[model samples]
Target: ITVEEGLEEEEITLPPLLIQPYVENAVIHGLAKKAGGGTVAVHFQRDNGALAVTVRDNGLGFRQEEGQAPSIRHSSVGMTITQKRLELLGSA
Candidate 1:
């Protein structure tokens, strides 16, 4: 896991756990499946007036399971909940 911050001296605040699930997914689903392991790179930057975060992994990409619901497919429950929480806070 590597974190690269490009925010410089700017400071921003986000709701708790806004980014954890993605990182967790990258590690558990992405890197964990590879035989020799891989890297998870998290980049944070300030683009225009908004904060941008990018999580990249060299693991196998996602494939949807058959018979899964559209809303839940390819997404963990924690991610769904975090999205909802962000929506409620008007930050998503």
Candidate 2:
């Protein structure tokens, strides 16, 4: 895994949990199943006092063939929880 932080790190404010779930998903759900190992990249930048974070990976992405079912392990609840956390942080 790699992390890239932009120059604006000291000037921006961010929630503690903002970047964890994405990075976890990138590893646990995105890259772990690939035949060969892959890389996970976490990027953070500050834009106008806001912190921008990204987690990316080169891995076996979600793909299902015809008559195939989607993976049961994938769920949208993590993202939903993250969104709610952000909303709560914003309102605080």
Candidate 3:
């Protein structure tokens, strides 16, 4: 896991578990599937007036079924809850 903070000295606070699921998925589904393992890179930066968080992994990606929601396709309950929370916070 590599975290890159582009904000320099700026400090930021995120809602708990907001990005945890993505990292969990990356490890459980991405790196765990590969024979040699892979890296997960998480980037945090200021994009315009908002905070940008990106989680990336170099592992085999999954295929989604037709008309399936991403959270459902990935079977990520935490992600689904996080999406709902974001929607409620008017950030989605």
Candidate 4:
């Protein structure tokens, strides 16, 4: 759970607004797929002069357009929101 290095650190760049929703989706839908509990890891750093944040989980992966299990729809929303946010941020 690497969050902003510091709120006041001028060198820290905040990700575009939609990032939160994408993260929420990964936890809700992605990790939730695991039978037992799972770990969600997130990292933030400066990569090649650009900010890079990644969310990862150990859970069942999916294929394009594949319907998620019924219990997983709630989580998928987050990913969807994140994608939209990135698009709006012109980062897509």
Q: Residue 81 error for model 1, in Å? A: 0.8
What do the candidate models score in CA lDDT, each in turn? 0.72, 0.66, 0.74, 0.65
- Looking at model 2, residue 58 earns an lDDT score of 86
Clashes per candidate, residues 3 or more apart or on different chains: 0, 0, 0, 1
Off by over 4 Å in 2: 1-6, 63-76
Off by over 4 Å in 4: 3-9, 15-17, 64-84, 87-90
Give per-model TM-scores: 0.73, 0.67, 0.75, 0.59
lDDT by residue (1-92, candidate 4, tens digit) is 77556433465555656457656666766776578868778776666766677887776666557666344444335566666767887766
Colliding residue pairs in candidate 1: none
lDDT of 3: 0.74
Model 2 scores worst on lDDT over the 10 consecutive residues at 66-75
Residue lDDT tens for model 2, 13-80:
66677678877777777777777878888776655655666788887676555221236343457766
How do all the candidates rank in terms of TM-score, highest first? 3, 1, 2, 4
lDDT of 3 by residue, 1-92 (tens): 33345565355568888999989878887777688999999887777767678998887776555443233344457778888998998888
Per-residue alpha-carbon lDDT of candidate 1 for residues 29-57, written as tens digits (9 for 90 to 100):
77775799999887777777777778888
Candidate 3 pairs with clashing backbones: none
